[model samples]
Target chain A: MNYRDPQLCELLAGQYVLGTLSARARRRFEGLLPGRPDLRRQVAAWEHRLPEVLGQAPAEEPPAAVWNSLNRRLFAEAATTPASAPRGLFERLGFWRGWAFTSSLLASVFALALLLGRETEIPGYVTTLASMKTRTPMWVVSASPEMDRLYVRALLPMDVPHENGCLLWIKPEGSDQYYLLGSIPEHDGADKMLKIDRKMRPMLKGELYVTVEPVAKGMPEKPAVAPSFAGNWVPIKI
Target chain B: MSSTPEVLGDLLARCALADRAAFEKLYRLSSPQLFGIVLRIVRDRDIAADVLQETYVKIWHRAGDFRADLATPITWMGSIARNQAIDTLRRAEHRITQADDVDEMYDLADDSEGPQDAAARERDAAALHRCLEELQGAQRTAVRLAWFRGMTHEELAEHLDTPLGTVKSWLRRGLLRLKTCLEGA
Candidate 1:
């Protein structure tokens, strides 16, 4: 393949940008891009030109939760693989799998609770811890007295600064385990109701710990920030 | 033109450095565009969000690879967004063909303006949008196939069942027209 032919390059570039290029052809082009500047130029030209055609696409705001989850994943990656970046679905799955073990544990609890008469208390006044300096809240922490459910609300006000999405966690005393409640919305002043089974709910000792992890759309997870909010369980005085 | 491309590009660059600020900025600037494009292709908000996150992860790692020569920041970002979306569509077993799909794909642009961009994009999008309008049907098809589907000539040929020469010609003429149109705009 003559990588230098302008017309051939443009033709190939157009197709590549259009995504009509075969998988094999794309690999070949990617192989050429690093070694051949001219090829890269052609590809770039197509990229610059084609975006207008895509203009008719609707402008949509992704729920902030996506960004929040992405940050958690990226930060988590930074903690474990700071030097070597995680890539592709398998790597992502590995990240999710590590968290899944905890989810599975929750699932097991759900099964047990359903079978027995064990009742779980819903958390009240779920609040995210604010940043020490800016006092900006970073995660969404919620409480639900309803067993098997989490009532989530973005604690940060509409104007308060924070990431778009967040990671939910519950730390019950004596368990040494952190319960993952997936991702939730952050920016908009809307409350999200999350369902938690026996496996997902932290069997709290009245006082429970909650944390949020920040995420973005493209990057890996950042570090899990320290617990932003804490609640105390007041024993019922008989 | 909206400020999306440049903002996204800037954020992408910052994200490469693991800058959360950049990541947040990028999300604010481009998530709507990414979400819009992906939602159009996938038609599911939840799945679109998943794709959006994955796309950003790719962007974080690959943002450094972005070249001023290959595409404008938005185009480059758009390419990533579109490709990830189509990949999800394929993975979900949506068997829609290319020709029909392009028609649906191009409808994502908003003629009704909302956000604003830098003066350069204003000039660039005007020119690019016009050039896109001037393209012949075949030329447009070739461009869309390459850009949106990430298809190569051979796959395009196979999918369209057209002669290789015809495909090449359409793509060439289409690109030239686009260049001229963009430059003039």
Candidate 2:
């Protein structure tokens, strides 16, 4: 294997990307990569060229659990306190979600609740939190009073502002306060599971909102922005 | 979410700054195609999932290393995925169990798309498809199987039932031609 020969390097690099290189040969090739920009360029060229040969392989979405597993392993800390950046209008809104939100979120919640009222009672309180602006479901939130588990599942990755983070809060029935459940699952952390504090179990019947708040360590005074997505528990008999 | 180079490049720039939102959006938009490619090479859902995780972790960290001057976003990212998948396959080569279930091996492309599918891909993909069509038939399938299955030289020799020497000769010729055709295009 002459590492100096452009022809041999191209052959090895091409097969490496095509994956036909034997393990020993591939290792030898890689050992040569960092020191040899020519080899690296050749390898990158083959890497760029070959996959396109297949044109497009149909996209198969990985099993949903993979995303959750990634969040746990990769972005755990960021979830706890998304980066604390400059405070904007996000930190000023406080726990206030009423009056301003009742018009849209409440109206949709009433409609969905009636839609679910006809179904049998299961143990879980499920809500599909849709964007208030676009009316597209962004997060499917579920709280189980029986199991004391809270799950926030993102339907699609939602974008959080650079200086802000999205948090899940439940406004328990007849209560003026919006209790923080946990950070809402974003594309990075798609399937987040939060434990429903023992005292918060009774609030399962209330409204669910995925709200935007300034990036702060731990819980904030409350969400400073109105609910980006809001819904009520659509009970499922599971 | 579209993966235009500009969009993915912007996402990569943000990811370098530790922007979780951009990283998430990048994963959401790009994972499917990368996963599809990996699932073909690794051939096991569990291992493929593991490989996909490793690939993205590398991407999140390596986003800073990406050179727009070198490759398109998918190519750069796709190469990471294929490298991860192939590495897993080769490292566990002696596992000798699931790897033997050749009957379960996917076709040339896991999800079979036809000529129109080739046309639908971006210019690079389409050009490669055309260049591939020009290769000798044996070399064409040989390279495709090597790519899709991540087969080693010995495995290719055995799988194709050709002599090891002949497979190497033909494969090298095939690869050389592919490079020439692609570069010329």
Candidate 3:
């Protein structure tokens, strides 16, 4: 559709403000509005002129819990996340400033990739997750974008509860949502080549976390509780 | 918490600066109408509350993007709420009410006019109301249901007992005419 056509712009904007656009269409239009001043103006004009329509709805105060939870979600969440072993992967080890340590971590990741039969140049993203308390690498996680594969190597024994297992989470850059990669069962071999959802392959560069969640039944669609572990992928130019 | 656009816009400005107090004030002032619209559309209070939460989260994050010149505070916020509800309704396997037998449900929908309606009426909405009056009966009702109930094209078609194409043309025509009428007024 030619958005430049004044008539089409007006119609789309009006339908948008009138609350008739489909969810998909509305998102597409909204996605377009940032670049289209004419469309934005039309949407604004409809909103400005149609206050009566907006006002015709009956007003009901939302439950107080709504505000309470909203407050917690936006404000209090960071302070409350219990980190039994909470740590950022690089900062705690001081790898950020110590070039030798960071380089060795990179080398470890490459070695693991080689052991997994992946091309050395094709390890798209890799990270070493160390236990916050132990200050020793616990897991070396890597993703091969070319094969859409995720591999986890247990450098140290994971001491999760018998009933619970490590739940891997992929958080794309700038997103609050955590996409479940897969579960790492208790008996997951020392070097387990895990199958991640192919959709998450491209999004693997942002962050990777392994939270302790129940995996007895299967991987729950979402983590049952707040994530305990928070860490990012080791960015690899290769 | 009652406020004019200037006050609300100022609150929004402060919210943009990451002031929780300003965000709370904005929510307290604007949430009644926003919640009201969301509840009426999504119909389930639980879902409505969830949708409202998402709406305010977006508003808080995007408060800096508000252009005071282009839109009023409540309407701008209300549009976000409405859009979120409609989007939720589409994704959720919500129910059949918005489909086949929609007219009775549309008429019986919880909200038609309330304090906000009267308050908005006394404000400068007189010209817009007059403009709305000029659309044909079907167009006016379709527009009203779409606004207040968040009715979709299929819902409006079923409710109006008209063909889908006819309903779409009617709504589009109604909006075009209203655009012309409102711009003139």
* All candidates: TM-score: 0.53, 0.56, 0.57
Q: Which candidate should be chosen as best, given TM-score against the real structure?
A: 3
The residue-by-residue lDDT of candidate 2 on A1-238, one tens digit each, is 4678878777888888887776677666766664577877887777666766644455789988777887777787455764333223232221122223334434444443454457522335566676543345666655544738766656576667776778888777667788888786678336666887788787766766778877666677677876666666655553
Per-residue lDDT tens digits for candidate 1, residues A1-238, read: 7767776787677667766655567667766665576766777766655555445366877897998899899778867875344434333432343344335434433333343324444343333333322223433344444445654445454432465345555555545566665565655445666677775554643333344544555322332655444333322211
Off by over 4 Å in 3: A77-238, B95-126
- Over 4 Å off in model 1, which ranges? A53-56, A83-238, B1-10, B67-72, B97-108, B112-130, B141-169, B180-185
Q: Considering only chain A, what is the TM-score of each predicted structure?
A: 0.34, 0.46, 0.51
**Model 3 CA RMSD to the hidden true structure, in angstroms:** 18.8
Q: In order, what DockQ does each candidate have?
A: 0.35, 0.30, 0.25
Pairs that collide, model 3: none
| CAPRI docking class of candidate 1 | acceptable
Worst 10 residues of 3 chain B by lDDT: B108-117
Assess the local accuracy of residue B25 in candidate 1 as a C-alpha lDDT between 0 and 100. 68
C-alpha RMSD (angstroms) for model 2? 16.4
